[model samples]
Structure formats: structure tokens, C-alpha cells
Target: MASLAAGASFAIQLFARVGATGTTLLRVGFASLLLIAFWRPWRVRWTGRQLLGVALFGLTLGGMNLTFYLSLRTIPLGVAIAIELLGPLAVAVTFSRRVHDFAWIAMAVAGIALLLPLGGFARTLDPVGLGWALAAGALWAGYIVVGQKVARGHPGPALGLGLLVGALIALPFGVAVAGANLLTPAMLGAGLALAVLSSAVPYSLEMYALRRLPPQTFGVLLSLEPVMGALSGWLFLHQRLAPIQWLAIGCVVIASCGVAAGAAGRAPEPVVGPEPP
Candidate 1:
């Protein structure tokens, strides 16, 4: 929910003379710096395996932000988020044995089909944007997988290190695109806000939630993200969706909700880590 609000603000920031890459760099960079200061990752002794997991987690985190932001350049925020959600949806359903699980997956597929430019009604969406959203989805899946491995203990330090690695990965491209424009007061302020809203606060909340709730219940709550994104985009950015698009989003959301509910009785897993921004 917070990410949705932050993403709406980020869309506005993108129009403030900063490119998408630059915006991503600012977000990850500020998040890294702030977290590093607070968490003091240097104090933690890292094992070789832990270091590798953090690195992989960072790679997926960077890729997810980069591609999702790039997609926003050409697609509406709600639509992009709905498309990108396939990653987590896939993760949720991957190990399921229940017959109803496949039904949820089918419904999600149907929703995606409606979003595609396969018919005249859906032809307005940009193909390149769709591709970028799909790429983000793939990277999101990677983020969840690697995050589970790296989030075992000391989530704050692990996240701080991961953000640093992500910032390093994204910074060069941001510099190349936005150049000195990113250093302006307006951009810096907006970027800082983005980092706090999209990264710090949400990450902390998710980590806390994971510790207290079953993963399935948490997943069910997280399923509301697309709906929140849609509402936020509508209210903040005036990015209204068509009726069909709304229906499509509903299908995906329902599928996610169903999957989460089905798994709600399962035993809770140990805390892994916070999800990527």
C-alpha cells in the first residue's frame, strides 16, 4: 500500500526532468545510504555464503526497479503493476498441489490475456512497456527467491548491504541519463522521499509483518497491492483505467487472494527478509 502511494509520487517525479534510470538510482542510492547509516552493516561479520546470497538479492532488486521504472515511462502505473505481479503470483502457486491452485493460475492468465494487445480494445498499450513489465516480473520472482535465502537473520544489515549493491548496479545508468539534473534540490528532495516511502518504511513494515504473521496471510495482504496501486494512480496521477482493465486487475487480485487463503492453514515459515522496492 505504501509502495503504491510512493510509486504515484515517483511517477510525478519522473516528469520533473529526471529520467527513469536516474530516479531508480536516487531511490536505491538514498535507501542504501540511509540504511547503512542506521544499520551499520560493517559491524556484522558476513559468511561467504551470506555474502553471495546478498549479492544475488541485490541484483534482482536492482533489475526489478530498473525494468519496472522503465515500463512506467510508457504504461500506466496500475497496468504496469498488475503485469509485474505475475512474478509473486507464480511464486505463490509454484509448489501447490491443490486442484484449486491451477484454477487460480488460470484466472491470472486470463487477466493477463485481457491486458495484452491481442484485440482492438487492448491495442493502445505499448508493446515495449509490456515487455519491460514482464522483465520486471521475472526479476521480482528472483527477488523473492533470493530474499528468502538472505533474509534469515539480521534483516536490517542484510537489506542495507543489498541496497548498497543495488545502488552500485543502478547508479552508472542513472548518471548517464539524468547527468547533473539528479543533483538538483528538487530532485534530491523527491528522491529522498521516494527512498523513505518506497524503500525504508515499507521494507521495515513487511519485515515486521513477516515475523508476526504466517507467510500465507502476509501474502494475502500483499495481494491488495495492485488494487492500492490502481487507486493511488487514479487519485494521485489521474491514471484512470478502462472497465476491462479493471476487470483484469480484479481477476489477478482474486487469484492471488484465493491462493493465499488456500495456504492460510499451513504452518508459518521462519522470517526470511524484506521484499524489494
Candidate 2:
């Protein structure tokens, strides 16, 4: 539900409401404050290796969101999300041997194919949007892998705070792009609220779920992001959906859900012992 609500918010293009860069800055800024207040990570001291790991996670998170917003400038929210989900889908396929997982991947591929308005190849494409979305998808996969590392290393709030430190580095660029519009109360409020909803809430929820679920199970469930985004886009933006579009979304949801159900009782992959101090 948090992921679905996030898609709805993104469909409104709140960043594009002010400007993508400014919107990114505002969202990160507000989220940083909230995370700092909630987690109080200032007290925690980090070793050099942990600091490097935190920085890596932060960099991936910032890059992912930046590219995603940039993609939204040209692409539909639903389609952009659908493509972004491919990053994880790729990762899942690489790690799994199960034949059913391939079937799920095929469902996702079929859904994405429908996004192309394929009557004539030359006349019907958003090249720039596809470029941005694909770029974002690569970064999204990096973010997930880095996020898992961060989650394992520190408590959530502290890791979240450390990630914010790197996100702040992105502010100058975002401010430059969005500038004065970013300062407007309306934009600030919307961007800040969006940060809480899209980043803060979903991050917390997913972390909670991860703690209780196996990595493969979590990966399977995460595949639902695209389908949820399509539904949220339809409901919140009144984005008109044709029957075929609805069928595409249904296929994604069912395939992902099937993967999740199959993984429910399976043993988690073995956790090797930690390295010696």
C-alpha cells in the first residue's frame, strides 16, 4: 500500500510541479530532518569501512531518486515504474534457478511491451524518456543492493541518517535547477509531504518486512511495485486505462504474487558467519 501510494504521488509529478531538481532537494531535505529527529543518529560512531558502506548506500539512493524524477519529466509514472521494476527482476533472475521465476519475469516483460505505442516504429516512441527510465532502473538496482548492505550494518534510523548525509550533497544541484520555485510554500509542503510518503514510509515498511522475510521472498514481493503504480496512477490521476492496460497490470500482480506465495514457507538462504574482528 505504501508503494502504491508512492506511485500515486509520483503520478501527480510534484517535482515537475515546482521543478525536478528543486523537488528532489526539498524532499531529501525534509526527509533528512524527519529521519534525524526520529533516529537521533548523531550519537553513533562509525568505523572507516562502515562509513564507506554508508556513503555507497547514500549515493545509490540519491542517484536513484534523481534519475527517477528526471524520467518522470518525459514518461508516464506507471510506465517509468514498470521499467524500474526490471532492475530487481534482472537481479532476481540472475540469482534464481527456479523455472517459475522465469515465468514471472516473462509476465513483466510482456507488460512492459504494451507500453510502447507500436503502430509504426519511427513515429511512436519517447526516446529520451526511455533513456531516462532505463538509466533510473540501473540505479534503482544499485540502490536495492546498497540498501541491503546498509540495513545489515546499522540500525535503520542511523543508517537512514547516514544515507541522508550523502543525499544532502545533491542539494546544491537540485536547488540550482529548481531555484526560487523550490522556496515557495506550496512546493515545499508538497515535496516534503511526498518525501515522507514515498521515501520515509515505504523504507520503514519494507525494512520491517525484510527483517521477517527471506531475501527471495522480499524480492518477489517487491516485484509488485509496477502493478501497484499502475493502479495508483489510474485511481489518483484519473489516468485513463484501456482494457489491455488493465490486463497488463493484472498479469504483473498475479505473477509477482505467485512468486511470493511459493516462497512463504521456504527456508531463508544460509547466512555465513561474520568476519573476525
Candidate 3:
């Protein structure tokens, strides 16, 4: 989580140099290469159904990255993340069986409402950016569901191949927009850093976590992402938040902690079968 936050900060800095699509391509592309080389995923013989699962996971993963980056173009990272979280919140609520879960979700909703530009220190944000963030959120939910299913197999092959698919989808768009700018030495260096911090490290951990955790638990736990994003934006991007927004973050954080506490002591779901040798 820390790695993802730090990577997002770096990505915002790189956006000034290469644009959103370029950054997405570089991050996903480099990450795919690194993971594939390390895991040597081709050693495992994948069944057709498993292959299809990875393809769907890759589609969601790629779409999520692309749309989230696009939102960052016009919105502050924290606000964008806060709005994007609605997807996970919805997922959590959908799977929730307890009353407290709904309460936590309501608190999260309150937090989101505080982020609205209706009044106070908040200003109107770009509708397009908000739309993109919402789209990213939907894809994020899809990624969580699909990732859990795929992670039941081998974490390495699923993540590496999924990223490769994403990189392929992003390649042409990145080329069309950034072109020669992306080839600069500085851009390459930054892109590598972004890939490591953003995609490679955190995603590996996320896949492992997804394999063990329930989807609703996984979704609610992601509330930390907004907090991390907000801090990173303030520290690195100098994007300050209003007092109300900070309170909003607090609400979500508390809600997440509550959910985590409730879920404590529960045994993780078992993996479907033995990992590929």
C-alpha cells in the first residue's frame, strides 16, 4: 500500500513529462517485463479456462489503470481516489450480511458527500475527471472479483500475464500521445521507478492478499488507499485538502478499521487446488 501511494506520487510528477497514457504504458509495460522474467510463468501449462480468467483479469486491470490515470489529469489525487473508492464500498456492502457493515458503509458515504463541491473549501472538479474516476472504480471492483478467482491458481503467472495484456492494450495510445517524449532518458528512468513502486511490488502483495482474503474484506481494507493518496498528494504534489475533506478521510478510515476488527480471527478461504509446480 505504501509502495502504491509513493508510486502514484511519482506518476503525478511524470505526468508533467509524458502525459497519462504514456505513464500507464511505461508502468504496466516495465512491470510486465520484470514480473514475467522473474516468475517465468510459461513454465506452467495453463488450461483454457485459466487462460480466459487471466484475460478478463488483464482487461479489468488495464482499464482500471488507464481510467484512473486519465482522472488524475484534471483532479487532485486524493479526491479522485476518494471518489473511486465508491466501487469497493459498493462491493463490500453487496456482500455484507451484518448490520454493522451497512453502518460502516454509511459512514463511508458521508465521507464521500463531504468531498462534494457543493460548498465550503471544495471547488468544482472536472466532470470528465470524475467520470473517469467512477469508471476506474467499476473496473476496480471487477479486478478484485476476477483477481481473487485467478489468484486461487498461481499468483505469478496470473499477475504477469495480466499486466502483459494491459501493456499491449495501452501501447498504441501511449505511442500516439507521447511518442518521442517517452523515449528520453529521464522518462525511462522515472517510468522504471513508477513500474517498480506502483505495479511490480504492490501488485505482487495484492495478489497474495487476494488469494487469502474475502472480497468484501479486501474491498473495505482498501480504504487506506485514499488516506495514502491524500498524504502523498499533500507532501509531493502540494495539493492541500480542506478541513471537511480531512474529516471525510477520517470517517472512511474509521469505517475501514471497524470492518477489519470485525473480520479478525476468521480463517482465510482455502485455495481451490495445489499451486502449479
Q: Which one wins on TM-score?
A: 3
Considering TM-score, where higher is better, how would the candidates rank from best to worst? 3, 2, 1
Location of the lowest summed lDDT over 10 successive residues in candidate 3: 115-124
**Could you tell which candidate, 2 or 3, scores higher by lDDT?**
3
As a whole number from 0 to 100, the lDDT of residue 29 in candidate 3 is 94
Candidate 3 local lDDT, 160-216, one digit each (tens): 999999999899989988999989998888888999999999999998888777788
- Each prediction's RMSD to truth: 3.4, 3.6, 1.9
Model 1, 42-128: lDDT tens per residue?
Answer: 988888988888899889988888898999888867667767877866765674567887787778767765655456736888889
2 versus 3: better TM-score goes to = 3
Q: What is the TM-score of each candidate against the true structure?
A: 0.86, 0.87, 0.94
Q: Candidate 1: list runs displaced more than 4 Å.
A: 112-118, 208-223, 271-277
Consecutive 10-residue window with the lowest summed lDDT within model 1 = 212-221
lDDT of 2 at 18: 59
lDDT of each: 0.75, 0.67, 0.87
Compose the digit string of candidate 2's lDDT tens values, residues 1-277. 5554563466357655556666667766777777767767665677777778777777767777777777777666766777777777776676666887778767766766665455675254577877877887887677666666656545466446654864686688787787788778887778678768767677666545545555545665666675666566666667677788777767767777777776776776443323211
Q: At residue 151, give the lDDT of candidate 2.
A: 62
Give candidate 1's whole-model lDDT: 0.75
